[model samples]
Target: MPNSSPKFSYIDYNAQTVTIKRLRQLSRLLDTVITVPGTPIAIGLDPIIGFIPIGGDVLGLILSSYIVYEASRLGVPKKLLSRMIFNIIIDSLLGSFPIIGDLFDFAWTANHYNIKLLEKHLNGY
Candidate 1:
């Protein structure tokens, strides 16, 4: 009898690796890196950009949306995609506040969370 499992001849694992690596770097840069000096916490461009006004969060949303788009292209399941969207929405909404929003952005790390979701989905978990 012939095997029934679908083949993945067209899937390029190397390309996927490069894409994921780039996404991981972006997530780290946007979420965590700089030390708070006097504290144990670290923050990145996400909170720094949040200082700008409407444009900050908008930029964050755009960058994070790219990750979601890539995940969809990689065949992530609908449920996982929905969860990823929820994370982005939460980050964008809460990170739009005044001083508190910057703090939220520092702690939320939606890009990191979405990457984890993508990894989980790819691993069949």
Candidate 2:
């Protein structure tokens, strides 16, 4: 019998390392894993956890920071890494607010933003 598997020559599966896969999953878990009923908007644990007061924000920061750490390990340039750090900082600062901060988390999505930065770096953008 002849081989019948389809191939996509343009798809570079090797380009996605294990770290990248984990980061993508983590980003989604932090930013867009849940959908709001009757609305197109989606949210993730980052904001929902932020409702727990001080500890929640700290935990969110820690999780978001891990993305930057992984990006550094992936050899992203220092300049780009700084931008990722800035995103975390902004998210942390604004997200420290009481009610408003939780609302901001729904939109900020620092993990998702940082993943984009990391991908752009990896893609040589």
Best by TM-score: 1
List clashing residue pairs in candidate 1: none
The per-model lDDT (C-alpha) reads 0.87, 0.88
Can you write out model 2's per-residue Cα lDDT over 5-108, one digit (the tens) per residue?
55333434465578899999999999999998999999999999999979999999999999998787666779999999999999999999999998999999
lDDT tens readout by residue for model 1, 27-112: 88888868889998878888898899899889988988999988887777788899999999999999999999888898898999
**Model 2 regions lying over 4 Å from their true place:** 1-16
Error of 1 at 24 (Å): 0.4
Model 1 root mean square deviation, Cα atoms = 4.4
TM-score of each: 0.86, 0.85
